[model samples]
Target: MKTILFLLRKEFLQIFRNRVIVAMIFVMPIIQLLILANAANYEVRNLKLQVIDQDHSSWSRQLVGHFTASPYFNLTGMVASAKKGITAIEADEADLVLHIPSGFERALRREGTASVHLNINAINGVKAGLASSYAQTIILDLHQEIMPVVELPAGLSSTFRYWYNPDMDYYTFMVPGILVLLVTLVGMFLSGLNIVKEKEIGTIEQINVSPIRKHQFIIGKLLPFWIIAQVELALGLTVGWLVFDIPIVGSLGVVFAFSSIYLLVVLGIGLLVSTFTDTQQQAMFISWFFLVIFILMSGLFTPIESMPGWAQQITRLNPVTYFVDVVRLVLLKGSSWWDIRSQWIALSIFAVVINGAAVLNYRKTD
Candidate 1:
């Protein structure tokens, strides 16, 4: 116990001595959160719309007006010819082109039907799909307003109620996930770098020659980082609540409880990576490789359901995926411990296995 406490004190002293690393541990994540929370948005907005209205009728004008009024679209160019609208799309100035055919209102009133040509830039498939969906919704709303009797079928109506995120704000969805990322970045990178920094400064050999046990050294290394990561997470969540208006629907105690175990997984992986590498560069590259894969597969930006079956199966092995899932489930959905029992259990098993491997791989004499 005395030996381990000595190692812990030494590790903390060394950490506090490095001003640049100390700043990185505390400052970088907050800056990343401020920038990334606004940037990592999935919601499609400001779609550049080009319109060619041949009919020039009041009804056609009203439809065009809807597109301009909608927050989803910006009418950047209006041309008399379809050729010009197509030019705007080809030139990359517009994302969508709308063509209202001649006699659009006349055909709608007389024949109860009209055709509108929609040309979309399909370069970015996701953005194109969202733009199409937004346009369709506006068109449907316009149809119900103009020809209420024809659009409705004997009192059949549909109502949408959004749960959790009522306004469908992207920040609400991204902030919690980003907080997970911030904690993860610190846990994996800082812990991995801590041991490697010792190797670089020649203190690793000095410690290995002393009568210090391996487990004591490893525990000393992990404890400081675990505490630091939790502090960063608390600060980040406070910032999220104050700046982004994110709500903590579940118990903060539950969040910290889950996070404590989850940090074991992240710190264990970091220790494992450090054991295999001699230099900070090697540790950083290895950690970055896995962290990138974990973040991408974690469904932070995209939906896991949209992934192929085999890819989704691979995500089950990723601890980041479980943490991201449980964090959002707890914070946004107010999910109880019972609701996330399977995930918490999986993470516990993962922590035990990973740390066990790290302990075995760490050699005192090497």
Candidate 2:
């Protein structure tokens, strides 16, 4: 009991003594939260549009007006010919080109249907897809407005309501996931480097020759990081709320409770890495390799359901995936403990298995 406390004290002292680490512990979360929450957005905006308007009619000009009025598009200029519009796209000056033929207004008035050619640069697939979708929607809206109203018998109509994120603000969706990432990074990188650093500096030799038992030494090494990670999580959540206006719809206690177990899983991974590696650099490289795999497969930036079947199955093994789901569910959807019970159990099992492996692998003497 007293021995573990003494070891914890020693670890905390060592952590605070390093100026760079202290700054990272306090500063990194705020900077990352502020920047990434704003920068890592999926919403496509400010697409450059060049229009080739051969139709010098009201409907043609009205269609051009629609593109100019939209926030999603910036109409660079009106070209006299389709050739010029194509040249703009080739020169990387425009993302999309709208070509309105000379008979466009006549076709709309006579046949009630007009075709507008859209030439979109497909260099960035996602941007192209979104820009195409947005332009199509705008054109469809104008078509509906200008066409004569037809009375039809009412059958069924569907209305969409976005539940958690009503405004569809990307920041709301990203902040919680980014918070989980920050906590995971601090726990894994710092704890993984701790023991290996001691080994490098000839301090592990002294600890191995001491009276400390294996589990006690592991606990001593793990607890400081565990506590620091929780503090980091709390700080991150606060920043998310204060800076980004992210709401915590669920119980804060539930958040902390789940975080306690999740931190153990992350810290256990670090300790396991430390047990196998002799130097901090080796531990860092190994930790980063696993971290990248875990984060990418975790559904932080992309939907796991959209992944291939084998890739989705792989995500089931990633601990970050579960935490990301749990945090978003709790903070965004106001999910209760029962809602996250399955994730909680999975993380608990991971905590036991990983920490057990780390302890078994650690030799009392070298």
Candidate 3:
């Protein structure tokens, strides 16, 4: 017990003694949250909206004016032909195009229907979705006001209320996800390379020749990094709250429980990487490469639904996806254990699979 505690203490001090590293552990995630929050917004603010007004009437002008007035869009171009509007939207000069047909006002007056063709790039699906909906709402509002002489039932008019983060601030959504990245990164890199350092220094052979069982030795070695990563998790989250005003809307105990289990798999993965690598540099590079791909594709910066079907299917096999999703659920959505049962189950399965692989690969013999 004393030896275990002493080793843990030594490891903790080694990690925290470096000022640059300590700051990076706490600061990088916050920086990423800020950058991603800015870039990850689904709202198309300052949207370059091009217009093709064929009607040349008050109603058509007013329609274009409505889009210009709305904060969600900016009128960047006014084209005489629909082809020019298409070129604008296609050439990256505009994000969306609004075309009022030649008979727009006339059709509305006589036929009760007028066509407005809105062409949008759905590559970034969320922004496209929001842009379309905002345009639709403006058009619908104008329609209701102009033609109030006729009325429809309740279904045609609906109001949406965002349950949490009503402002749709991406920072609030990204803080927790970045927290997962920070913790996972610290645990994997430190634990993966620490053993390599020991081996490089000829200390690993000294310990192996002793009576220490592989499991006990491995667990003792990992315990410090594991605890330190958890501490970093707490500190990172606290900073996120104070700096970014992110809220913890769910149980801390639940978050910790899930995090603890998830860390097992992460640590196991690190140890597994260390087992295959010859040096600390190799371990670090491999672990970092693995982490980058896993985090990027894990729905941390974007929604899983927005990914291609094959990409989404591939992400399902990545454990970080579950970790990020569960943490976000707890933080943003106040999801309880029952609400997160599927995540818990998937993480449990992941833990079993990874730990099993690590144990199989971990050997005392050369």
Output the number of the TM-score-best candidate: 1
Q: Judged by lDDT relative to the true structure, which candidate is superior, 2 or 3?
A: 2
What lDDT tens digits, residue by residue, belong to model 1 across residues 12-70?
89888988878887899899999999999878889999999999899899999899999
lDDT of each: 0.90, 0.91, 0.82
Overall local distance difference test of candidate 2: 0.91
For each candidate in turn, give its C-alpha RMSD to the true structure in angstroms: 1.6, 2.0, 3.1
List candidate 2 segments past 4 Å from native.
148-158
Colliding pairs, model 1: none
What is the per-residue lDDT of model 2 for residues 101-217, given as tens digits with 9 covering 90 to 100?
Answer: 999888777766679999999999989999999998889767666765433222354558899999988988999999999999999999999999998998888889988899899
lDDT of 2 at 125: 93
TM per model? 0.96, 0.95, 0.85
Worst window of 10 by summed lDDT in candidate 3:
148-157
lDDT of 3 by residue, 163-262 (tens): 7778777778877888788788878887888888887888888877887677777777788777877887888778778888988898877888898888
The residue-level lDDT of candidate 3 at 145 comes to 66
**Candidate 3, overall lDDT?**
0.82
Backbone clashes in each candidate structure, one number apiece?
Answer: 0, 0, 0
